[model samples]
Every structure is written in C-alpha cells, then in structure tokens.
Target: MRTGGKLAWGFILLLGIVHWDFWLWSDRTLVFGFMPVGLFYQVCISIAAAIGWALVIKFAWPKDVERWADEGRDGGGEA
Candidate 1:
C-alpha cells in the first residue's frame, strides 16, 4: 500500500481504539454546564472521524474503483 493508504488505515485504527473512551468512564465534568465531558469528547471524535474520512476519500481513493465507476457512467461496461 502507499503511504497515504497506510496513514489512512492507521487513522482508522486509531479512531477505532479511541472510540472506546475508557479514560473518560470515571469523569463527571461538564462542558458549558450542559454536555458532559465524555459526551463532548465523543462529539469531537465524531467531527474528527468525519474529517478523517473526508481526507481518506480525497487522498486515498481507489483509482481503479473510480475508473470502473466512470466506465459504467460512460456506458463502456457490459450493458
């Protein structure tokens, strides 16, 4: 795999590991006195995951898959 692919997979693995939030299990702090710290942290994680996936799509997208899709769009594939 290429460097970007490796980094994207590494980011995915990191997100998987971080999603457990075990370190926040005992925390009771609240943010803006409304959202719990853990909840806020998870929200941040969600945002990060969104941005990470966007980056993966932008930088690590599969050219072959895209080409196949384009072929179908251009009616170059078996009809």
Candidate 2:
C-alpha cells in the first residue's frame, strides 16, 4: 500500500471513532445557542468527510484508472 492508501485507511478509522455516540454532553447544551452539541459534532464530522474524500481523490485514486482514461481519450493510436 502507498501513502495514499495509508491515509485513506487512517481517515476511515478516524471517522469510525467519531461516529461513536458516547459523549457526556447533555441535550440541553447547545452550540451557538441553536444547534445541539451532538448535531454540531456530526456537522464537524461531515466537513471532515468532505475534506477526506477530496484528499483521497487527489492522492489515492487508482493510477491505472487514470491511465486507462487517457488511453481511451487518445484512441490507443499515435498522435
């Protein structure tokens, strides 16, 4: 596995850990006086997920897939 693969796996594990709902935050505790603490935490998780996906796409996307796409675009013939 390459660096990207390791990063992807690490990010996945982080998400799994965040999804555990064992926090002691009370329901009455609100973030920004509107969103509940749990909701705020989930929102943060979502943002992290989006960023993680971007990183994975940039660094972890299969090189073979990119090569295949280029080959198809070039029609497998000399320029």
Candidate 3:
C-alpha cells in the first residue's frame, strides 16, 4: 500500500481506539465547567474522526472507483 493508504488505515484504527471508553471513569471531571471530561474527549475524537475521513477521501479513495466512474462517463457501461 502507499503512504496515504497507511495513514488512512492508521487514522481509522485511532478512531476505534477513541471509542474504547477508557475515560468513562473520568466523567466526574468538568471541562471548562460545562461538559464532562469524557464527553469533551469524545467531542474531540469526533472532530478528529471528521478530519480523518476527509484525509481518507482525499488521499485514499480507491483508484478502481475513479476508473469505473470515468468509464461510465465515457459511455462504456454497456458491458
């Protein structure tokens, strides 16, 4: 795989790690006196997830899919 593919896979793994709930016990702590620490952490993870998805789309989108799209656009879909 290419570097971008590796990065995209690593980011996906990180997202899985983020939801493991190891910080569930830290809920008693408040961040900025508004939301619980666990919730805040999850929110940060959400943001990271969004960024990761964008990176995957930008860098790791499959070449085969693109080729198929182009073929269809060129009226090569009869087969």
Candidate 4:
C-alpha cells in the first residue's frame, strides 16, 4: 500500500484500540493518561500527533526505494 493508505490504516487501528481501552476499562490512567483530560482524550491527542508526524514525514521525505535497491545492486562501495 501507499504511504498515505498505510498511515490512515495505522491511525484507524490506533484509535480503535484506544477506544476499546477507554470503554472496557475503568482505570485507564495507567495506560492512557496522567492529567486532567482523562485517558481517552489524551490518547486521541497522541494519535493526532502521530498522524501529524506521519504526514510530515510522508510528504517531506518521499523517496523511491528502487533507487536505493539499484545502488546496492552494483556493490557496497562508492564508485
């Protein structure tokens, strides 16, 4: 899959897991929070941050993996 798709799926899975934890457990502080906002909200914010980071990296540093593969095919030393 493309980077964007992978990121979207990752975010969805993370959110789902967080949601499950928030609903299934009463004491979420140990896993998801240490502040006033509560565990679920804290984890939502964290997921947002991760999405932002993924976007930045995906858009800012996109490269062709095949280029690296081609370079390695010749040998391991600089020409």
Model 4 lDDT tens row, 39-60: 5565676877687567656654
Any runs in candidate 4 off by more than 4 Å, and if so which? 1-36, 74-79
- In terms of lDDT, the poorest run of 10 residues in model 4 is 27-36
Candidate 4 lDDT score relative to the true structure: 0.61
Name the best candidate (by TM-score).
1
Clashing pairs in 1: none
lDDT by residue for model 2 over 1-79, one digit each (tens)?
6888779868967987877767735655789989888888888888988888887777777769767767648466677
List the candidate 3 regions with Cα displacement exceeding 4 Å. 69-79
Residue 16's C-alpha lDDT in candidate 1? 84
Pick out the ten consecutive residues of candidate 3 with the lowest summed lDDT: 70-79
lDDT of 3: 0.82
**Residue 61 error, candidate 4, Å:** 2.5
Query: Which structure is stronger by lDDT: 2 or 4?
Result: 2
The candidate, 3 or 4, that scores higher on TM-score is 3
Model 3 lDDT per residue over 1-79, tens place: 6898789879989899867877586467888998988888889889988989988887887869767866647555565
Q: What is the TM-score of each predicted model, taking all chains together?
A: 0.77, 0.69, 0.74, 0.32
Q: After superposition, how far is residue 71 of candidate 1 from its true place, in Å?
A: 5.4
